[model samples]
Each structure stands twice: as structure tokens, then as C-alpha cells.
Target: MHAGTTVELLCRLETEPTPDGGRAVVVVEVSDHHPARAVRARQASSADETRGHGLQLVGAVAESWGITYRRDLKTVWFRLLAGPHDRVYGPPARFSQDDPDLQRDLRAAELLAPAPVRRSPARRSDADWINHGALSFLAEASDLLSGQLDEEQVALLAAQLVVPRLADWCAVWLYDGGSRDSSGAPPRLARVWHSSEGRIDALRMALEKDPPVLPVPGPQRDGAGAAVPWPWPQEPSGYGPGGAALACRLLAGGRDQGALLIGRAGLMRFPDEVVGLIEDLTRRVARAVATARAYRNQERISQVLQRRLLPRGPATVPGLESSVVYEPREGAWAGGDFWDLFDAGDGRWCFALGDVCGSGPEAAAVTGLARPVLRLLARDGYGVGEVLDRLNKTMAREATDSVAAVAAAVAAAGPGPDAAVELRAEAEQTRFLSLLYGEIVPHADGTAGARCTLASAGHPLPLVLGAGGGVRVAAAPQMLLGVVEDTSYESESFDLAPGETLLCVTDGVTERRCGHRLFDDDDGLAGHLTACTGLGATAVAEHIRRAVHAFAATPPDDDLALLVLQATERR
Candidate 1:
């Protein structure tokens, strides 16, 4: 009865006449194509946990059940008899242990176990434990399953949760994209667990040889009737001697992710209640699987986008030690902060650090456009100031087109008057940028220091740290890029003497928050750079980076980027 097993049910009610009163008999028969676990029990009760749970519940209440079988159908039947002499007046009091029905239930328990050990005294009252511990177990299972973002890890957790609680052994099979018939990909065994850990591998090998397959249009396709009896594994011997097992499809959001197969070492047939519990677990597992896959896919796409937007890394700037730190905030596909250092023609090296106004694909678009144009202009011998002027004109033109596009899309949706304001705000967000651009020329003799020319466009001013710990601003701030095409930019020039460092950063560092205080609230970054007078470029960058992180108990929400350029001694 693995997965696609067919089942049928029939009911019969009869009344027998007596001298004083009549007795009524109600019988139900459940038939299936294969031999079932409910029929093998000679006597069933609460202690007979291996005997099917449905039969145990029926046996607890019914006065007597008659065996009804035919050659054509494999079936089991339960009969309930009520005579006029028994409780003919009022309903039996409370359903506690003092009731007659419960007293009879105690006798049924005795039939299964002369000495029954109970997890709860209330459960010992009748066959109620069939539904007992189920809620608490599912809650714990959900807690364990939540926040899991790896499919294989979800499978492992599912197996561990079920073993010893719901089954003696458990196995999880995962499909790559869809089930075999749908995706043409066979399911892979993701995890196998057993109460006794030693038997897992052998049982897994056995199960793999003949894993249960649920194809299209089966009962597994729908949510109801998710669990079906599965044959016990025959591999490595002794598994099938006196055990029962089943496979339940793991489905969520109308997608089939995998299957959960569970086996009990000493059960006749899996109790229907237990099957229901496993079915619920399968649903939760499927959801966890879907969630994990979604997270992985987003991470992958972010990676691909990042590669397309940024270079492999910055290049070496000769005669000067250069170090950079870039940390994108977590859970973001792309960050606003970006930096590049590359060789320009004629002993000139070009470097720029810029921050887009926003994040994700929008920021990615601007980043993709800016870097190549900057590199092309610098290599063609454009000075830092001239490059900014030309890049600003280009950015302004792109911004106008972007705003027009957004307006068209928004207008096409036929929204109300507020749409105009929304369009303006969104248009303002694209292409607007804060940037610091610089060019360097070594002393014409490959010495320790170089002449630095730089400008800032509404960006944090660069700090110059001398070997003696004095800090000075390297450049003054100007209008931001992409804001106006008619604006002119100015550049500042200075000699980077040996052992002097130029520090540049995006807002992420200057605005890092600790309580109400910012990292650079009152020239704090300058003060920190003053403390690293003797450190190398990398050391200075890392020290300032660590200090910024330690300033706040909470991790920085904004993307962080810093570039350190120190004039070094010739090797």
C-alpha cells in the first residue's frame, strides 16, 4: 500500500428483537487490495500499540466486533452493539475513569499489557493517547523546523524529529526541481535516521534500491490522504520480520518537493492517527524546503548581479600602499557603496569611491553605467575634475530618461493624483550619487610618495594623516553628480609625503550609529585616523574598520566602504 494504494469502506446497521427490548448492531468494514495491518491482531487494546490505532479506538468502545471477510476483498470490520438494558435512562456521567465505559476500557488495556507503563495518567484512561502528545510534538517540530534555509538540513532535521517519537526509523527523499514524472529527475536520498543510529546506512541502502515512487494523478498529488502504507525494507535483513512502514508526500504551495517514509519496528499497520500526524509533518517539511530553496536562489542571483556590476578587485597603485574595505549589508542583493582603483595612461593612476542613492537593481544600474565610463575617460587622459564634469552631464541625461520611463509606467497604470508625487520621488532616487574621485602621479622616479589631485561631489571630505598624527582635510565638497548638467567642479592638489595616508569613506562609516551618537559625530573619523599614524595602509584600514564596527552594538545597516592610500618607502 505504498503511496497509490486503493481503499474502500462499507457500513451496516442492524437491530435484533428481544423479549423485553431490542439490541442494535453497527458494523463498518474497510477493504483494500493488499493485506492490511488492521486484520492481523487477534486481540487489540491500548497496550497493543503496534495494532492499528483505528482498531484500538473501535475495540475500546464497541461491545464486540465480528470478523467479516470475502475471497475477493481484503478487509477488516468493527461492530458496536447496544442493548436496551444498558444505560437506557440518562447519559453516562462524565467520561472519567469512574464511568462504566472507561472501566471496560481498562479491561481492554489489561488484555494488551499485564503491566502498562504510561506517559500520562490521563492517556492511560482509554485509547486517547492516539491523539495525545500530538499537538506538543508538532509545536516542537515547527520550532525546530523554522528558520531552516537549507533543504538537506531540513531533511536531516525531519528525520531526527520523527525517529523514536513517531517511528523507529525515518528517511527523506528530495526531488531536484519537481517529482520524477514532472521534471524527469529521480529523487535523491537526502537523509536517513533510526532510533538506533547503527542501522541507518544499511536501511538507507535497502530503501534506495526500491524507493517508493508516486507518479502523476495519484492521491499524493492532492493534500488529503497523503500517507499510504509502504512495505518494510528487506535490505541488510530483519527489517520486515515484524514491522510496518509508510510513505507520505511532502507537498507545499502546490509543488511536490519530496517524500517522507517512516517505519516502526514492531507494528502491524501504521495507526491512522499516526499517519495523520506524519502527514502534518510532511507539509511543514515541504514548506521549509521551499523557503530554503528560495533563499538560496536569491543569494545566487545577487552574486551574479554583483559580478556583473563590479570588477574582480582594485589594482595595485605603484609607489603608494592602497587598501580597501567593502562590506555590503546582509540580505541585500546589492549595496550602494562602490570603489575602483585602476591604472590610467602616462604614469597616472585613477581611483574613485562612489555611493548610489539607493540599493538593489536600481543601484546596480547606475554602478554598471558609471565605472566603464570613468575608466574610459581616465585612460583617455581626462583629469579628475574634467571626468566629473563629463560624467555629471551623462548622468543628468540618463536621469531625465529614467524619470520619463517611470512616469510612463506609472501613468499607464491609471492611478490617482498622488501618482505624480510618487513618480517625482522615485525619479529623484535614480542616478543621484555622492562621489570622491582622485588621480596620482609618482615623483617620476618610482619613489616613496606621489602628487595627489582629488575632488569630492557632495561626499565626505578625505582626511590626510601625517607621520606625526596631524589630520587635515584633503578636498572641499561640491554639488552631487547627476543633479545639474551646467555645474562646474574644482580639484585640489597636494604632495603625499612619505608615511602620509589619505582616508576616504562612504556614509556607512561616518554615520554608523551607537545610541544617538554617530561614528564621525565630531571629527571622530579624523581622530581615529590620527591614532593610526604609524600603521601601514592595510593596518590603518582594518583598524578604522574594526573601530567603526565596535562603536555600535548593532551591526551597521548601511553598506560600508573605505579606501586607504598611504605613501610608502621604496622597497
Candidate 2:
């Protein structure tokens, strides 16, 4: 027999009776043996004669051939061993068709068999595989719990863990509260999460069907028309093997915020080990959502408070057109940029813009306190210089750890159609307002004049936008506000031609960063102002604000307060 062939043979001996020339067995013992087995048995006198080329062919192909002897007859059998390209046949002897347990075991073994080596490294140990899977699941869960994972992240995680692991497809859908119905109103079908994109689309198409998903709150239902419930089915249709789902309500401050849905396909029910991990992750996600909501609420409150404290309307003086713009810092922090234009009575206006050095509730508090105090000082007839002195003292005394700076101006309007001329003379006498203060007044002939009073208490210089498109630095400044009680400030006056414009701004306006250069110290701000000449005070202020933001490539780190004063040709 050939090396790979299995064979069996049976032979029998018989005595003949002469009735019809037929032979009959008579107590014969049969012996069977074979080195080679014939593939086919044909009409021949004996087994030896039948072993022609057929047996040679069998011997060449068979791995091994064998035979045994029996009492009455002999039987033969042969099996061909599989080759490199040939497939092995037959179930093993240990295989039992009726035993499901055995089938499951075999299936698992097949599933876990070593795959062909590719780019991926081999498993270091069984523990390593378990640890890697567990850690990955935990990381995803932690991100969800921490609010670090967004909707996209959650969706990706679900696909990674459930799709191939459970051998099924999955998708997640969120209720879109902003969606409107056919009547241009919000419809009920807006809430639903599914593992199948097709299913999500179907639910959206049938939004009016009053499906199972419900809207987060109110009387409306989700796009799927389903009620919001805890542990909602991960799968929309509840069928399939290894298939299971879980839904959990998102809550913040004891109110339903949203919901999370997770699912896997097939008969595999979620084991306690997996379910517990999912539950923990859901809790973290819920907590993060709550925190985000709270942060938004606080931001809204801060914006409202800041708006209320700052001036909403421009200051109107007889000979002067003035506009002030205040922009808060970005992010969650409440800024300290504060500006107020108070009617000081009798054709007079008192304006002050200041920035506290920090952010958040503390900065807001300082702003809140400083606004009222500055108003009171103006009411008490305190000069701009004295107001700064008192403000510095109050801040220093009240908040020792806080550092702040302010630039302020106080102008008294003169009476009659020649008020501009009268105000110009008054501006010339403006001595104590500090070097940082700028005053604009009209001469008797209706020509405009400006005096820049600057104090370099470590503060930035102001830029002047000339009416004829001339950009130049304003009068030299002195020390900043609140540094010393007895510091002296200087003022210089200059003539403002027919269409000249003057800009008085806090450092926040010019202190923006452009790549590696600081705008406050460079000529970029002056260049922008020069380009924006001939614009109205309001327009000029807005242009400067936009330019500064562009230069910084982001929101300014400090609060920005701008004051634009333009002199029209009196046309």
C-alpha cells in the first residue's frame, strides 16, 4: 500500500455443490491481507489474478493499505491521505453531532486559532490579550465619563467594540432639538440612536410615525417617536444573535439632560462584567454634560452682568462725537474691562475705562466694585487724576493681591454755538488728568485742537490718527495710574485740522501679538489706524477692534477698551 493510503481487505474459502454448477461455503475460515489494494474488482479467477494495473495505481496513491481475516468472509477498505492541495475528509472520531457543547468548544477553538503572520506582533501572553482589551474598553469608557469624548468619539468606540466583536453593524443617533417640522415648527421625532445607518435614516424618514424615541423633555418625542427611558434598547429592532443594547439617561443637577445608547449584534447578551463597565462610563459622560451646562450658565450670567455694568450708549457732547467699545476676553473667564459714560451735567461728560489684571468671578467682582466707586468719584467732582489716585488706593486697600490699570478722561462742555472754541480753551487747562489722558476741543474759529496728557505708570502709549491720513505717536506719556500718589503728569496740545481724527485706547487695543512681534510696541496698530482714516468714530473703533483680533490670531489676552473721537468738517 502507498504511504498515505489506508486499506482493508477480506477473503473467503468455499466448497462447491454440483446442483447448478454453483459453489457453496462449508465451515470455511477466511483470512485477509494486502500490501496493495485494487481500486476496482472485475471478473477474474482469483484475487491474485485481479491485482493488475488497478492495484498498482492504488498502491502508488494510497499512504498505507491493510487487511484482516474473518471467520466466513473477508472485507477490504482503503483511505487516501490528503496532499498539499487536497482537502482532508470526514469528521474525527471524537466529534458528536448531537452535542452542542462540543460544537461550541470547537467553534471557539477555530475562532481563536493563530492567524497568518502579518504586520501585527504576536501576543506576548494570554494575560496581555485580556489586559489590552480591558484597558482599551476602560480608556474609552473613561473618556466618555469625563466628558472628554464627543459624539463622534462615542460612535467610534461603539463601532470598534461591538461591530466585529459581536459580528454585527451598529450606529448611534441623537435627538436634534433644533429640527423643525413641515409646519416650520419643532417636530416630535427627534430623539433616537441606532447601530445601523440605514435604520437611522428610515426612522428619520418616518418621523411622523410616532416611534419609540422621545425628546429629552417637554411633550415632544424624538425623531424615532420613542419615549426617553433608562436602559433603552441599543438595537432599534430587538432580534439577532450576540445582540444586546443598553441605554442610559444623561442627567445634570437632577434633570434629564440627554441619553447614551450602546449596542452589539448576535446572541451574546451583555455579561455583568461588560455591563458594569458601560454603566460606569455612562455616569462619567453624564457628569461631564452636567459640568458643561453649568459652565455655559455661568458664562451667560457673566456676559449679562458685564453688559449691565458697562455703557450701552455713546456719549453725546455738543462739540464732540465720541464712541467707546469694550470687548471681554474669550473662554470661560469673565473679564474686567469696564467703561462708563456718565452725564456730568451742564454740558459735561465723565468717561472712564479700566481693566483689572485678572479673570473669572474675582475679576468681575473688582469690576463691579470699581464701576460704582468711579461714578461716585465723578459725582464728587474728583478730577481724572484724583479719581485714579482714589481708585488705586481703593483697589490696593481692598484687594492687595490684585493688580489693575485705568485710562480716564473728564471734559466740561462749554455753552453756546461756539462751545467747541470754549471747550478747546478748557482742554488746554487740563493739567491734572495725567499724561495718558487726551482732550479734544474746538477753537473760537471752529478749528479743532487736541491735548495728549500721558502717564507711563508702565502703561502703553496712545496712537493718533490724523485727518490727512497722517499716523504718528501721541504726546510723550508719563507713569501709569495707581503707582504713586504724588506723581506729576504732563500734557501737550496740538492743532487738529478740518478732518483730523484722534484715537484714545487702552493697551489692550495695541498690545496684540503678531507672530513674534508685539503690536503695542510696534507700528502695526498705527498703520491700521492710518489705513482706516476718514471713518466715523464708531466705524474707526470697530475697524481697530477687528484688526487687533486678526493681528493676535485669536482673542486678546487682556480686556480691550477703545475710545474713538472724530472731528467732522462741520459740513
Candidate 3:
């Protein structure tokens, strides 16, 4: 026998708890290289100290000993009774196939062995011994599970990783609920496959014909790391080990993602060592599957909420052309920046863009509230200044109510030393918005022209780009809305030439930081607008977005919103 033979024999050792201590079985498959043979230990000579002592010790301790071969696989098994019971049984006996009691024990031992694999006849180097190399198999499993982000993909990869390497067939079941382990719920079958397509189809047919081996009835252990006995045949119909399958739960962190079932043809049973290796492999698989599931869930939720908060598209406006481009900050569903264009009245249109104080759901909530309120106030024929004033008052009242709610909730829970501090912070959590609100009235002239009245509320002044390439700040910056109730705002009027454009933007564009310098202050945006003098509204908006992205050292740290309006030539 070669060195790999000893390793293979060790890998095939399995133990089961008997009524006494236990029964340890070692299975050595009969193959072309090794034929069926009988062995007799040489009698220890008077001078011989250790040559045959190995078998003598085995015979002395074992209450029973036997060898059995089924389906071309031979198993060598021995049973040792617990304590005083062993003394009553005497020494181990020779192998026997005709003894009814011994025959039944051997049959049961064969079923407990790991599923057998059909090894290739080709000779390989010591480094490659097929399934016998447990360490190498684990390394391969680790490499296969890395970098997979989808739970289903991870499960599929796990099934593929074990086949033709560890087992002939593999099935991965995963818990579908939030709980970590199977203590609360049963795992659902997630993926299954076989080394050969024929076997896969046969297994599928068999599964359809019979009930799956449900989880066995036993005391559910929280962290037991071994293969559970699943009462499923290793192969379909008259093939493989009959009704012998092993399953180990896959666990990572405190959660149990599910279990892995491994099966193969014939009477080959998995050893305790092999089961331990499988348990470790499943741990890695569980963590990867969990992470992938979490990320996908978050992404789906974010996409849904963001779609609701943003406008369907820029609202249609006649004679006046408009376009908007919004990019959220990384790692958030929605950012604070918002913009909309809506019909205010006969021959009048309202377009406003604003940014709330922060990012995420809190800011999104304020954005959600501010946009419609601005629309309602403007449609009711409120002037730009009056709109900002009313918005400030409304936000202030909302903030006061929120602070009161926080204080009450905290008080009900019983105040601690930090309670007063927490209350002060909540009270100081006043929500605010910076806005540029404008109303455009088109000229009755046959030529495409418009009169735009706009007010600035703690927002960047709108940029008026002339057809002649001159960039001018259109209105003086004023107090931002949602800060002080009585704060006043002023309006300014400007004419849009047939080819001129007005650009409204959130602070994400102006405050874009490269090192310590701002994008707008360094003439980055101004220079880009000058070069895009003759472009239409949509083209100019896209050009600015590209320019900002290219100029930034990193992705924009804030949300970006750009709204462009241009007076077009008559068609």
C-alpha cells in the first residue's frame, strides 16, 4: 500500500454511538489496484516485542470484530463495550459472514460509512489523490466561495465546489427567514446538483416520486458541528448505498443559513474527520450567502423609494426648453437635493430647486414634503418671496412638533444623566432648506422669448449664460428657507434671449471639493459654461455633469441636482 492508502483509510474512519461505548468502522474500497484478500496476523514470537502487538491490542480491547464487503467496498469494523460490560464479552473474534448477529451489525456499519466515489484509474502525483486530500479540498472550496455577492449564486457555487471533489452529489438548503439558525424555522432547499447530468436527472425524478428526508426528530443543538443523519438513499433506485445520506448545518456568525447534504453511490460512509471538514466549509459559505442577501435587499428597497421621491421626468414646457440631471451621493437611497417644474397658472410656469440639511431618509422626508408644498403655494399665485416666507414658517412649526415628540418619548422611558443633553440636541434639530424659486411667463411675441422672476433663499444665485458667452450671477443670495419665520426675501427679473440659458443647481455642484479648493470658486463651472455657450439646455446640463465628474478627485460627497432652462428660437 502507498502513503496515500493510509491517508485514505484514515479519511474513511467513522464512529457511531452504540448502546455501549461506540463502534468505529474503517472502510477500504476494493479497486483494480487492491483485490479481495484475507489477512492473518503473524503470532508474536518470544523475542518479538511490537511487530504483531498492534493486532493483539485491537483484539484484546474490542468486544467484537468483523470485516464485510458489499458492492465491491470492504469495511473493517470493531466494537468496544463501555466499562464492566467489556469484561463480560471477552476478546474479539475473527470475521464471519454467516453469523446472523454479526451480519446485521456489519450491514448497519456499511450504511454508516461515507458515500463511495468512483476513482479514475489514471495514476496521479502525491499532491493529487482525488477526494482523499481533505486539506486540498478545503482550499479549493475557499477559493470557489470568494467574491460571490448573490445568495443564489453562492449556493450554486457551493454545490459545484463539492462535486467530483468531495461527494458525487450535493444539495445546499438555506434558511429563508431573518433568524440565524434552524432553531426557529426549517431550512428551504436552495440548490442541488450531481457530478453527472444523468445522476442529477435521476435524483430529481426520485425526489419527485418520494417525500424528502425532513429534519430528523432529536434535541436541536445550537452549535453541534457534525453531519446529521438524513434518511435519504445515496442513489436513486437500485444504485449506491441504500437510504444512507449525511447532512451538516451551515452556520456563520450567530445565524444558521441552512444545511448541506452530501451523497454518493455505494456503501461508502463519511468519517468524523470528513464531516468536520464539511462543517467548516459550510461556515464560510453561510457568511458569504448572508452578506449577498443583505446587499440585494437594501439595493431593491433604495431603488423603490428613490423612484417615488424623484419626478417622473422634467415636466413639459412650451417655447421654453428645460432639462434636469440628478445624481445621489454614494451609500444613500435618496439625497437632500430636489427639483421640479410644474404649471402655475395660465401662461405661467413654476420651477424650483432646493437642498435639505442632510442626506438619507430624514432629508428625503423633508424633500418629499417641500416639493409639493412649493407647488401648491405657487399654484395658489403666491409670489416667489411670499412662497419662501411661508415655507420657512411651515418648516419651523414642523420642527417644533418633532422636538416635542422626541422629548416626550425620551421622558417616558425615564431620564438619565444624558437625558437633558439628548433633549437639547433634539430641540436643536431644526430642519432647513436652501431654495431658488422662480416663475417664468413667456412673451406674447411671435419670437421665442420669456420673462423670468426669481428669488434666492440661502441658495446659490442662478447663473445666466448669454448667447455671447458671458456668465453672470442673476440674483443676490438671500436667507435660506426653513430657518427664521419672519425673514424676508427679494425677487429679481431677467430676460432670456432667444439663445440664452439660465442654470439652477444645488450646492453639490458648487461645493465639489478637490483637495481644499471648491469647483465653482476655481472657475471650474464658469469655464465650462463659457465653452458651452451655444449648446441647448439638455446638452449644457449633460456637459456640466460630465465636467464635474471628471474634475472631482473622488466621487461627489453630496447629491448633485442641475436644472437648465433655455429660450428657444421660433420653429
Candidate 4:
């Protein structure tokens, strides 16, 4: 059935009802089948093996089956008796050798015996060996790739995994993303290695001295080839030639990220199966490399952008110590969370921690605008409430204009498939921010040595860790900014004696999740803060960061920013 379905034989099926059940029979006849040898039969080599087991299966499932042949035709037949009353031949003893009927039946059965079958070696398909080896290799490769995100490590792993397994020598080269050469110039060689550890140095030197052999554009444009033939021309003492080579294109996201070159010396030529296995390996490697590159690039850019948005260092103030920690979510392109500290002169220091409502470049733009504007207005002598009021008005105005612009663009684009999506997003136009801003004014107090004022705009209340290891939220009244024009905010004043600490963090800290439970406001953040009351500003900030991260089962889903301020001396 697996081979084909065309046949020249005739088949007949008959059935008859019985008192207990039913009886059925099937007969297949082949007439003058040119070569009688084609009709020979043999028992299956094993019970589990399917070849030559068709009659055996019928005999077991259907009560009886036999073959009879004539000079002009061969008829094969099978019968089934569904009733329990009938007992057919039970054992070999039941058919005595002395009986004439038994002898006649034995003679007839001998005519159906199969002639000697000429056994031939089974042909292996290209996928058989590849699937067996590739399954294990890919599993190991996946584990290796997951353990590291650096492209260099991935390339090194690829080279090492292929050597001694798929090749005697292997080398991996990656494109120099930062190369300043013209596009036509060859890609810079990033890695080169051979199977023998002792011969690695010599092989590397030869590779370095020779110009890179870029693959010619073949049927596949991305690139696939061995630049130089094996058997080192310069240093052939340790290794000899005649080794067949393979070049696999490292393609990721439809682009050629790199190439893997492998060589086998002597008689170990790459079969089609091995070549297919290498191709699959290269495909996985390319995807991993591409992902690693993209992640690294994003991290670099995120660091730069975040640094520019936040102050390089904490605000310097007399009798105060401050520390901050900011960690962006892994793989996130934009950091909506931001914090800043800058001295506003005259013994007053302004600091703020805020989170934009969204992420990506759009949220980054809003953050850039908000952080600097807050600092500028505070330095210009605006009170905490007044600064937020003005900032909210500015955000509201800009958001309105942005919506109008997007709407116009959508209308101009016409009613295409993408246009409706754009229109919907623009129509929603929800851009807002949760902020906690405050001005710390140094003053003397009898019980509390130093005093400061804090304010909020729909932000989490600050946690004040007392000198004696007490943690409680400092309450304040507020509304989220950028949602409405002319929004007003209320301030709360709290005094911190020496050794007391003020811990303020974005929602990314308290909202972190562990399974179904959240590191919530009442118990989670406050509980961690109580344990670090006497710690210095930097230690307290780091403690909170560690605690929140430990509580989350997975990596933080949003940006985390924390600001810690400690009263070191009396005003």
C-alpha cells in the first residue's frame, strides 16, 4: 500500500448469515501472472515485523486463511466464523500425519510455500540518520544557546559542538556589524578554530595570513561554501589534505548572520544525511545569533537613553545621603520608568520617580520630556504642586495635538487594513504618567532631626523606615498626571531623624509577581524595608531591588526604579 495502488488481480468477497452469527470469505485470484515467482509467500521475519505478515494477520483475526493454485491461475482465500460454537483445528496433534486428509492438506500447503527470497541491503533515507543524530544535537544545542546570550559564546559553542562529531575541523565566522568598510568589502572574520587543540594555533595563523574566502553567490544568495580547501598549505606537517569541506549558511530572520565551515579529513566525506543535519544546526544557530545581536543592541541603546533621561549621580545635599537603582525589563525596547535628583539651591533638593503609562519609543519620548521638564521647573522655584500642575497641562495639550495629527494621517491613508488599526489606536490616545515628586527642605526639629516634604500624583506612597526598624507608608493625596488639564496635587510632610531612611520606588517593585501572588503594597514592599532600616542609602536601595527580584518568579515585566534618601546628620 505504501508503494503504489495499481494492480491487475481480481478479488471477490462473500458473506452468509449463520444461526449464532455470520460467516464471511474473501478470495483474490491472479491469472497467468507472467512470472510465478512474484506470487511466492514467506512468513514475517518477526512477530512485530509487518513484511510477509499479511496472511498471518488474516489467519489470526479471521479464523482461517489459505492459498490454492492451478496451472493457469493462483487463488488466495480467507474465511471468518464469528460464532463460538464452531471449533476449528485446535492443535497440530488434531491433524494426524497418518490421516490421508491431513496429508492432502499438507501437500496443498507446500505448494504455497515461498521460494528463497534474495535478501538485499535496505536503503536508508536521507532523513533516517539525520533525524536520529540531529534530535540529540539540537537538544544539546538548545540548552547551550539558552545558557548564554552573547554572540561570541554562541559562535564558539557552535564550532565546538560540530568538531569531532560532524567534522575533524570547524570554523565559524560572523559578520562585523560595526564594520566601517564599504558594503562590497568582505565580512570581517570573527572566529576560527580547528578540531585538534594542539593544531589550533597553527591553523589560526594560516587562516589569519590568508584573505577570507567569501562564498560565491550560488543558488542560495545568503552564502554557503568553504573558502579554502583543507590540508593546510603552509603547515601540512600536523594535518594532511584530501578532506572534504562543507559551508552552511547561518541565516536568521531571513538574513545571513554568519557562516559555519567544517572539514573532514580522509575518508569521512559528508553524506546527504550529515549535510542535512548540519543545515538544521546552522538554522538554529543563525536564529540564536540574530536574537542575541538584537538584544545586545537594544541593551546598549536602552542604557544610553536611560542615562540621558536620569541624572548621572544623586543630588548632593548637606546632611543627606541618597542612592538610586534602575533596572529595565529584559528585552524591553523602551524604559517608561525614570528617576532624577538635582539640588535646587538654598538647602532645597528636588527628586522625583515616575512611570509613563506605556512602553517603547513613544513612552521614552514622554519620559524624556517629563524628567527634564520637572527638573527645570523645580530649579526655577516652582513648588511641588505647581510644577505638577503645569506639567499635567503641558502633557494634556501635547496629547491632544498628537491625537489630531494621528487622526489626520489615518484619514489621509484611506481605509486600508492597516488604516483601521492606526485609527483605533489614535482614537484611544491614552497617554498618562504616575509620579511622586518632592522638595526636601532642611530644617531642625526637636524629635525628628531633619524634615522634608513629599507629594504624589497617582503614585505609590513612600515608605519611611524609622531609625528603630519601623516601616510605614507616608500618605499623600493626588491624581495621575497627563490624563486631564489643570489637575491639582497635595503634599505630605514627614520628618526623618538621623539614621532614618525614605524609600520610594516605581510600581515595578511592589507589583512584581510570584505565581499568583503579587509583592503588594501593604505587606511586600513595607516588609522588605523594615529589615534594612539601619542600612546606608546604597545598601537599602540594593536590598529592596534584590528582595523584589527574588519575589518575582520570572524577570521583571516592567522597568524598576528606586530612590533612597537617608538623614545622616541633624539640620
Best by lDDT: 1
| lDDT of every model, 2 decimals | 0.75, 0.48, 0.67, 0.66
> In terms of TM-score, how similar is model 2 to the real structure?
0.51
Best by TM-score: 1
Worst 10 residues of 4 by lDDT: 115-124
Q: Give the winner by TM-score: 1 or 3.
A: 1
Candidate 2 C-alpha lDDT tens digits along 1-571 = 2223444433343444458764433221223343223334335344233222332233233332222223322333333432333455776567567877765433322332333241124213324433445555455445433442243343343333433322234333332321122123323332333333224444344333432343454433222222122332433443233355555444333444444455554434555555555455545554554454444445555666566566658666545567787776665456666666666543345655555555554456566667787778767765555666676566545542221211000101101112222223222222112113433344555544432233223345566677778887655655544445565444455665555666766667766766778875647778888888778777888888888887766667777777776665553
Measured with C-alpha atoms, the lDDT of residue 77 in candidate 1 is: 65
lDDT of 4 at 405: 55
Clashes of each: 0, 59, 12, 0
User: Compared with the true structure, what per-residue lDDT tens digits does model 1 show for residues 371-464?
Assistant: 7888999998888899999989988888556545534443422222234534456546778888999998988877679999999998999999
lDDT of 3 by residue, 498-553 (tens): 88999999899988888888889866677888888999999999999988887766
Model 2's alpha-carbon lDDT is 0.48
| Residue 281 displacement (Å), model 2 | 2.4
